[model samples]
Target: MNEQHILEQRTPQAGRLLIGLYPARYRDLHSEDIAATFAEATEGLNGRALLREHLDLASHALRLRLRIASTDPAGRMLAGTAPVALALAAGECLSGLLPSLTALATTSPQARPRLFAVEVVLVALVFIPWIVALLLTATGRWRRARPVAVLAALIDLGVALVVLGAYDRAPGALLRACALAALVLLAPPDLVDTGRRGRWEAVAVALATGVPLAVLMDSRVTLLGWSWYEVPAMVGFWALLVVSLLLLVHLSARRPDRLRALGIALGPAPWLLEYGIGATHWVVAYFVVLIGGAVAVGGVVHLVRRMLGAEPA
Candidate 1:
């Protein structure tokens, strides 16, 4: 039999589904060639091996469609930011889950069956997809996670809007949530390895996200209880602190590319959306001062490094 026939035999139905994920423009030009190549490569693979290849292929296809698989600095920047975005989504799920569990514990389902049922469904809709996506990304299957994350974000946005309209809550929290969800959806898929460093980075991100989120959720003043309007500013401050510490650590260790560092900085910056887009103007000047201070400090740092010959002029 010819190679085409052989390829047809090897390509499973799921493989065709992956190829179909490609854009129509690209598929029209090269789907057959791509499919045939994939089939030939996986001709003898089966079971877990085949599934692994399928996931890898799916990730490649997603990166292509998202236009984020390039080796260029922009692509690298997005790749760096994407994993953090997933971690933040996981953090949000954790944050929301706490209140949900509390409500379940305090409220009797038999006393208010309909209300309890609705709450359960809402929690499932808004949070489960994010947790699932986080699990997938943690396992290094980011391409498959992206679509699931997107679904989670949509559910979050929808629920936020409903809560805003029905309960008349301050839009600040909802808007910030929407902004963070948007960031998670737009970020490219992260290409992570099952390595020690990758595992550590994952843990660090989870801590960063969880710590700030927990602080914000606190209701007691001694524990950092701040109003919803204050959340953005608090998150922004935490992000800046983390960035400063990272910069200092890098100075003593191996320095990262400035551009990639900037991208990493952005992973913690969704809070800026509150003042900028959500119009929580009370914290506007606070961010301005923080930004100005950062710029001035960076200038001094660069000048000192140049004078000391630690960095290229």
Candidate 2:
């Protein structure tokens, strides 16, 4: 095909989508060069190459998007302070379960701290920001972005419910009733960006979700005997609790900016309370493991500070 013919076939929108992955600075200066390269490289490429190109494009785009999003005003406001809240919440809730590698791998006792440290960092970086954003928006910060957050929170809830059902049948070692509350509060609500009053809706959802999630955990103690698995039921229990809290926040949130600020701001209170309770248990029942766990937390904190380029938190 002639160069002119091929250029005529390409849409500007499609070109933009493909080029969106490059850094803004780079794109601003060299977009045509990059596009020309991609177009020439992709022309007559084999199927595998085409797939590879698609993925490469997507990966670069996502990298740029995240880099840009982290600095965007709204995104910063949502994540700047909230990730810490969600991280503490998940860490507090899952402290006991993280080290139990009773699955296929035979975990050495000496390696537990390192393993737990890795788990904490993964959970903090990958999961916390989006989850907290969902909660803040669904509960109160209704915007064009709210629907996406709400959908994700729902998926989080759905996964928890699935685990809850499994607990009903086979039983497992799992968290207590409070995990339901944690899951609920951590989620946003079901409403789209419809400017609906969400705080009360969230509250009702919380109460409703809480009762069943609690039942699931309690029954697991009876049905499945809450075995080694309870240590890792972190996800299900957290879902119920986060969703419930989101319900309440949806009903009560007065303003979006305030709500966004509050979502991150308020998460630590419950986390601190839970942490104190868990610490007491660790001291009394699992003193050595608890000490190791504390050490692990310190190590992980060091890692987070290093990775995020902040002082030792």
Candidate 3:
């Protein structure tokens, strides 16, 4: 490490790109220091070591920008929500699995073994790894869980490429797989600590996930005649509707844990996103009403607080 060499490596292009991922204000103040430190730390690294460093940097950058950093109460709320959200996404997948599999079986018989196998592989890639990650996280083994989830995500990407090459379309499961993997990996490891409370959260998430799975699988519970997929969306919409209404109450009441409650309310974000991606007319309306209603209520509350001299000048 001569001075010239150090200088050149001190602000490597790759490091600068990563530092750019930070918020604009933060990057302006700290990008030079951050890039210099990263370059120095990674000078001799290459191959998997270099890739790992890049992934870690990118993951942390995302966590900070997303408010899931694990240092603040709000971040802690998201960290706690991560595993539960993953479970809920997996449950959504499971809710539709039988119908999907049955359809594949009927359609692929004797003529499309390759396509059928690819689909099954896609399902396994998304579902099994997520379940394993959930189990690992639930049992307080985040160190193991993170790597497992990441590897699964990589495989999903690779399979997605192959599927696209062969069929000109990627599997739909890829989106959910990546979303859950990001949730598992970007979550601050320290925020989801091991202990009774951690175990209880995992346990509750698992049991709640099972309820949707059972109901969707039964086919007898179609009160609204909603499809298997729509059932979960309906369930999630109502759940969020209730949470948003409760959030309005908490906002008025000035509850201290309101931020945490908001985080919990957002736990269904992964499921909601999947639904929104290909939602039908009614489904889109459900989303709009919930989101619009929440925003309107929050605005009203803010105006009331301002009028009452309850808010700061």
Candidate 4:
């Protein structure tokens, strides 16, 4: 293009594009001033000045995006929620399956009345708190939600009292089972506290979970025409209880993997200990010693790492 066209078109238009990046209120008054400055500054430059202007504008937009993304709390909350969302997926799966099985077993003619009582109790237990908490949430009473959970749990205790009024046929097995489920639903693992208190909390939940699992296994063994092995079934139920308790101990001590490792170690540690080389039940004692020693060593390593600030400073 010619000099008059170049001054009139290229420089002024290119400068206007740069000013467009600013908010409209800013550009409305300054656009023409910026265009004039550019027209004067680049008056003698060739075509390459246009390319330099575009590159500068693009870099500015990217910096603004990074600043906003990092500073927003909502963005951080979403990142945290991803792991919690995964945990909820697993919780929901168990909830759906357990309730369905309980529902199915309760449908039989003999099982119906007992199951109905259980459902009534469970419905009261689960729905009442869920409703009250929901209502409080709707009215912006979120600060009171934890207290509401406690109060809701108390009301469910009243439901258990109502169940006691009937007292039919040696406590009606299904009702007992459903009551157990309601207790589980009312106070899930999520409600438990963290740290020192968390240890006991973990143990209690493990005990409660173990009982129902044992009962379910007992019932399963009876149902699948395994009655001939009734003795073995009861023995197996007890075995599971012991294993679960051991698991609970490991969890309480903050060594879940240690519990699994204990089993793996049991197979190999006997030979390593040469059957403990002394004492009554010496082979069994070796496992207790090995697991305890390993955990102590791990704790020492952790402390050293913490002191060195190799963990988190």
Candidate 5:
């Protein structure tokens, strides 16, 4: 055929190749419509115009693939869990630092320098990789983030093991074990494609859950050593936890992915351990009880909805 006829024929084939990059289900649903659109868009185009059309097609295909992947339940779960894990780790690091600093302050001047140096090294080992992994995950670089997160968890577990050997404390050891489990669960081997919106939402959830707890811990508000206002504050904290757990359960049920549900359920474990075992705070323990109650309530809600043929909240 003539050059124009040959170019027109080739353009549709190129468009098909680009569209093939989409997920199989997506292609099955809309491939014909997409191909027709592509052919219509590229009609009479050649040289630079043709090149620009192909570039746009390729870019659109890539974006569609990413969007589909990011919406997967497993991927969303990993994205949601990462920020919460990082917040817990930051809190643990800060708690450890305070005691180390306090002890170092009382040491002799020469001994202080040596002790402080050790603390600095330990802090670097504990925090740097975890922080880098958090940044990578937040920015939607999941392929790189997974390995870094795993490395951070390994280093943390090693540090915890060393501490357990030195101190032989059950509570501290148990907390570390729980933290390690959380990190492992959050960092699945497969790349989790979380988009910008998912990353930001995860961050917001983490901050909302963690900031208040940090404030309480820093202010030393314990149930045992309660002030007049502390009783009301404890009740408020318990209510918040119950509401949070109910929301999490509702969201998880809607997604219908067991891993996502489990990840969200375990999101509070580190904080629970912090208050329940490590710090032994009565208020925190009571909050844990509220979580259990919320879970039971969520179960009843789910059952009622199912019976009524209603959608999960």
Candidate 6:
């Protein structure tokens, strides 16, 4: 039989649908080739072999979609940031859950229902949309993802504001607000199509701006007396700092821009030192403070060079 006839006979309806799952541009470029390959691979296969073939096709389509998405700067940013966002969301949920559960268990029966209801709403507000947006972004659904992410950020900011009000500008509240605001700012809009370098630069700007604000707002006086909740909160805070640092390193390597790398690196150092000092780790805090001072000076020098229209050394 001819190749066309063979392909038509071997390619199942499900295989066609799986291929269709890829973006239209991708399909336009590779659909025929992919279909032909599928037909050839599945030829004369039955039952388990056919099922495996179908699974392979679906997997290939998913990989193709992701590969296509990775080509876009916004998509890359979304992909890189999604994991961290989800991790933060999980941490927040856990933090809320522990206290809420304790309150529920301790409260009188009459108040238990009210506490449980409030906890449920709080959990929903804190987690659902953020998690959904991360999943959607991972799957290459940027248009649908953007609004969901924005809603999640708004909800998180509102919660942070309430915490700030109740606790008189708590560090945790400020950090939460800054983190969500950073995410909201970084979350790519479908309208503006920027390149990878542009996206990384945007990330650098967001971190450089947000990190200092968070650091300044962090009232470290209470760190001498640690609460159980502070453990998780500290872990989340350090995780964020580490991620931001790694991102800066990546951008510095990938792009030729040194100014952004310097700005981001310098901006967070003082904050880290302050955290160490607040936690009473003096040796480390002193060491970091020295390093931060040097980097800050270097950053200042770089800024001066830029002002003079000279390339940074």
* Per-model CA lDDT versus the true structure: 0.63, 0.42, 0.63, 0.39, 0.56, 0.51
lDDT by residue for model 5 (1-313), tens: 3654544464577776888887788787876667767888888988756765675566446645665234456555654454445544543444444555565566675756776788778767776776676567678665555455556666766766777556544455457445644444434424333677546644555445445554444445565786424443342343336345634554436444545544555555554553455345664655566655656666776777878888644
lDDT, candidate 1, 181-203, per-residue tens: 55544444453333565445655
lDDT of 3 by residue, 54-155 (tens): 777777777778776867666777665565665554444455555666766677546878887877876777567756766777788876677666776667
Count of clashes in candidate 2:
42
lDDT per residue as tens, model 6, 28-56: 78777788988788879887567656754
When summed lDDT is taken over every stretch of 10 residues in candidate 2, the lowest stretch is 169-178
Question: Which of 4 and 6 is the better model by lDDT?
Answer: 6
How well is each residue in 109-228 modelled by candidate 4, as lDDT tens digits? 465678676766676554456345434433434334334433444453455456544643223323322332222222222222223433332233333433444454434445456652
Predictions: Cα RMSD each? 5.6, 18.0, 7.5, 23.2, 12.8, 13.6
- Candidate whose TM-score is highest: 1
Return the lDDT, model 1, position 42.
82
lDDT of 4: 0.39
Count of steric clashes across candidates, in order: 0, 42, 0, 0, 0, 0
User: Candidate 2 or 3, higher TM-score?
Assistant: 3
Candidate 3 ranges with C-alpha deviation above 4 Å? 1-16, 23-50, 62-73, 94-116, 143-186, 218-221, 224-232, 235-258, 276-313
Stretches of candidate 6 exceeding 4 Å from the true structure: 1-91, 94-111, 170-179, 182-227, 230-233, 241-313
Residues 1-313, candidate 2: write the lDDT tens digits. 3654455355244555778767788677866666676676677876555654554455345545555233344343333223333333333323322323232145453668787666555445434434454356445553322333323334435544555566542122123223323333223222122244433343333334334444444323443556334543333334334533442343233322433433433333333233334344532333234323433554565566668987433
lDDT of 6: 0.51
Q: Which wins on TM-score, candidate 2 or candidate 4?
A: 2
